[model samples]
Target: MPPSAGVDRAPRAAWQAALRGAVLAVACLASTLAAAEGQPGTSIATSVASRPAPAQAAAQPAAIAQRIMVLERQGRARPQETAAEVDAEITRVAPFSAAHRELLTVQGLMLAEAADGAAAERSALALDDWHLHPGAQEAGLAAGAALLIRATFAAHGGHDLKRADALVQEALGRLPPEVSDLDRYRFVMVHGYIKDRAGQLEEAVRLHHQALALADQLGTPWRRAEARTALAYSYFGARQLERARQLSDEALALASEATDWVGLGRAHNTAGIVLDGLGDQDGQRFHFEQAIACAVRAGSKRDEARYLANMADFYLKKGEFRTALLHAQRALPLARELRDPDSELVALANIGFAHISMQHLPLGKRFVAQAIAIDEDRGALAGAASTWLELGGYLEQAGDLRGAVAAYHKHRKLMAGVLRADEQKAILAMQEQYDAEQRNRSLALPQREQQIKAEQLHRRDLQQLLWALAGGVSLLSFGVIVALLRRVRQANRLLSASNQVLRQHGERDPLTGLANRRAFQDEMKRRAADGMLCGTVYLIDVDHFKQINDHHGHAVGDAVLVEVAQRLRATLREDDLIVRWGGEEFLVLVQAMAGDHVDALAGRMLAALEGTPVAVQSRQVAVTASIGFATFPIGPASLPVPWERAVNLVDTAMYLAKAHGRNRAYGVRLRQAANDESLQAITGALEAAAQDGRVALTLLRTEGQAKPVEVAA
Candidate 1:
């Protein structure tokens, strides 16, 4: 049902790791120290002991802050040593002091790095006490950093994203105005990452751009590399492969020049994802290998695990199941040792898929069940849904039809539940926004009412004082009339604006921002009224879209649709009308053109989609569309065809294209002059009409083939 289940395709879990692995490397911003300054081997105890008692007393907090920064950098490689050092520092510092809070912040970051979520949350809550004594210097900054650590871990663990977003916002708000650019950059990157995970690609891109700007301002190559890598990942999620590749390459160069191993590892991983989407299997393999090398050189077990899983996925996709199994086995221990559930899950899923590919059915199903259990424990519905689908594919491949059907049904049910939950979240968001607006209006109402009363009192006073002055009274009356007219006009403007907003919302497909059926119907009606309904209509449907949703999850499916809409806009003329005609289908209306030109345009549309694979969630998915087109003003008699009938004809042709192996276009044209009777006969059965020579059909394919078919009635 989904292309032999799992042999050739990269598992969704591996793609997710590729897309998010860099987030671990960049989460702390302390890694930038290696490039900005020097190695982080300076001992805090020695530095403090060397200072005189008086100087130590004055600069103790600053020294502790520096040590915390160094530990953050070291914690990536030597987490246990760093944790011990942090504990010693915390023991020496005064409880709840600025230095103590800073140590607590670093502790939380380490705990999060180790994937100890409960511990991290406890640390975050402990840090929240800083809010009670907000007057302390640097209290907000320490608390904010801890909150961010918790937020990042939650987001990556596939926990509550909404809560994670709120945490990020809270952290941003808590940041002091005088914080360093590096601090702000970390916050922005984390914010962008959270937004990206939440399916807000445009917003995520904007935030990443802001981080890049901050990096440029900071003048650090490592910072720039991290920002570019992050931005590249965002672009990859949006299916802009070329842009992602360029950015990832730049990040690689910058990281290499700066000797920033963490940055280099992330850059290589990002480049691998882009190369995979570009269909350069060799290039992706090389990059993934380089990513693992960089991670090992950096001594970051967390990063090593992620990169190893990615490499295993690559080998799995290439049909090297044993190689994949070995790599996944290696990654699994590292993930479990780090207590990193995200990496652990990826490793488990890859192992499962590899085992299944190797004909170890029972073992594979056991591993898959473990992965699913992890997802359920974390309440990751999206992950669970895709895993269920993958299980279904495995069952189908094993020839267990009944088991496959049941698994598929479970997958569908889980996905439907996920979609409904997302809808409820969206509705809740809208309600909150509406409530906020209402509160603002309520707050302004009293002020407005007071101003109105003041104006009326002033007018009454002026009328009484000017009772004997006729000219003054007349001027007051005119002023009142002008005010009334202004108020009426203002109300009208507000009404018009509200109506415009409503119209736009009603007529647009929210997912792709394309015109919907209502807008298309309105356009058709307008065109008919203007007697200008002469154009070619094309109906395009994405091939195997349901399978994509089943294999990749709904989020990636939505990304595919959005990318397709963008590609359509890029390929078609600006004046052409594009609409989201139906689920996984698009309709385009081009200005009247000859049959040959229409065929050429249809070919362009097919090539636009099938030319390259779309990148989504760090995986490459090949997408193609089946299109059917027809130019109106039928037969040699120039019979005016109604828009509805024209649409029906093109729909038929679209189905024919689907029937003919897809990735192609079919065009319908009248063969000769036909009366109403013949037109009805032709419309009743399009293929029959073509077979009888009542119509001529043209076929164009992306494989560079074109032909005309006709028969005598």
Candidate 2:
């Protein structure tokens, strides 16, 4: 029934709390310690300035040190009194002493476990008082240990990859070569981790393999598990789900064998994500449950927060909005407690996304805005980029056009920066590869020198022997060299010609000899990014083209399509751009247009195809086309969107034209004033027509009227 006795009888989290309370009660009361002297935590001073009895100094520290290590093992839920005791012992313990060094490491780890990265950094900084030189036995070990703690804190607690990498590299440089393989494994793991976080997955996999090799060399099961998990994460990012799952299973098995709950939790979480990607709901759920359970058992608040965030994302992906919100809400407090901006960003973004997906626009926007603020403050570029994109979609769907536009702009800006950073990383990788090659070449220089020396010594004899045979072989060698040079030139010429053809093929369709879809999209994307090219897009379909293909065979059908492309191109203005959108379709953009000219142009396009019969295989074939068009800046009051929307609208109109009797145009007019309701109505109509193929199906049975339908202005 006694407090101390109850500690051992309690279970799990309860046992942990009981142990803390019992230890604190004993330390707070001097009489209890006096009654049971030399008990665990009995010798630890309650105040930093308090010194132990000289006779007790030797014995007391040993007991306090052992107790502190026990608390360190128990996780980060220790009471304030327990920390005070450790601090008091820190001051009383001799500087650079074994007890002091051990306490520093434990304190540093404890701060990290609390998700207090800044405090952890400060704890590690206290090691400077030792004044030990780098690579010195105890001093080097202590410094390396501090840096490892600091790196881990930076990585998980703050998501400060740059800081983490620096700390790890510093440790690697300072630690002696004879340092334990376990320490080396930890030191090497940071590079892969940062690369993975930064979206450099291939580089991360390579580094993780290096870490795995070191882990294997050390025969450390836990680190081997961690390295495998890290590699699996990169594979998951690359969407190689089966491989990711296999590696994750291996990692989980190793972690379980080592009783490494943290590793087990991370591996399970990764497995869940991979399973979700594979659409294995039962497998996903199992891993998700296991992950959460392991996170709780591991007692790492940072890991717990991350697991909650991952679950939120999982539910969000599944369209389970309320469940996502619940997990995200639980994560937010822990993220704030940890002061981890990245975690906060994920939690807030998920909450916003769930709300927005559930139609709570205002509430969702507020949460997303808060997340953006944190990301901006922390310089978390990837997080900011993704959140901005989500906000853009949310705002656009909510009909907040201006806000949506602004969010999209921000998203594009961040994406551009991310792309540039990724490109830089790729360039760096290439440079490193080249530098390694150059170094190898430099390494071979000495061997070349030795070879040259041996050759020079034999040169006199060799020159005499060569003089004997030179005259007879000279003509043959010369002829062979000339022949080889000519062959090399011929091959280079052929390769150049081949590459030229390939480049041409990339830009144009071989059959139609028209600009391909990739070329069109590239041009449109460039214009969109530059805030240029706002006009009208015409989507055209040859009426009953499939029937023509079935009746005339594909050869004649291909010829008819080519004729269609030619006729359409002949009618377009020099400034307009046209592309073979797909089979039996053509998309034209009126690059620069005069006021209300697009309507007339559409009419002319329909008339042009009807005016001429295509001559295919020396036979005239009757052909008529239906054209549908949509203009940018949906109405006078609105703004232009990316070319995609314009293309989709036109495509819908084209189908409707095909349905309501071929050879007519249906279009949405520009420069006509319209309210927001009209735009929404048009969008709704397009969506309905698209979803059920109602326009393409029903309108074909319409009354004899062949008039084109007017779209929203």
Best by TM-score, which number?
A: 1
Clashes of each: 0, 0
lDDT against the true structure, per candidate, is: 0.70, 0.61
Model 1: per-residue Cα lDDT over 1-713, one tens digit each: 12211212222222222222222333244444322223244334333234335534665555555556556555655555666667766766666786777667666765664556776667778787776774655787877887798887776554666888898888888888897776787678778877776766666777898899998997767668878987887887766778888999999998787777767887888888777666677888898899889878877777888788888877866778899899989989998987777667777887887888777878987887887788778777767777876676566655655555556555655654675535745754554454333333343244654554565565555544544444455556766655655555555555456446555755777779999776776787778874334888999999878567645645677789999999999999888999998779999998889766887788888989998899987899999998978877776778787665577567767756665556877888887887756765565466667777778878777775445433231
lDDT per residue (tens digit) for residues 38-105 in model 2 = 43453435454455567766667545544554444333333233455567667766667756766776
**Which regions in candidate 2 have their CA more than 4 angstroms from the true location?**
1-115, 129-167, 397-403, 410-713
Candidate 1 — which residues are off by over 4 angstroms? 1-52, 55-66, 78-80, 90-101, 131-135, 176-178, 394-401, 416-713
Each prediction's TM-score versus the true structure = 0.61, 0.52
Residue 565, candidate 2: how far off, in angstroms? 22
lDDT of 2 at 266: 68
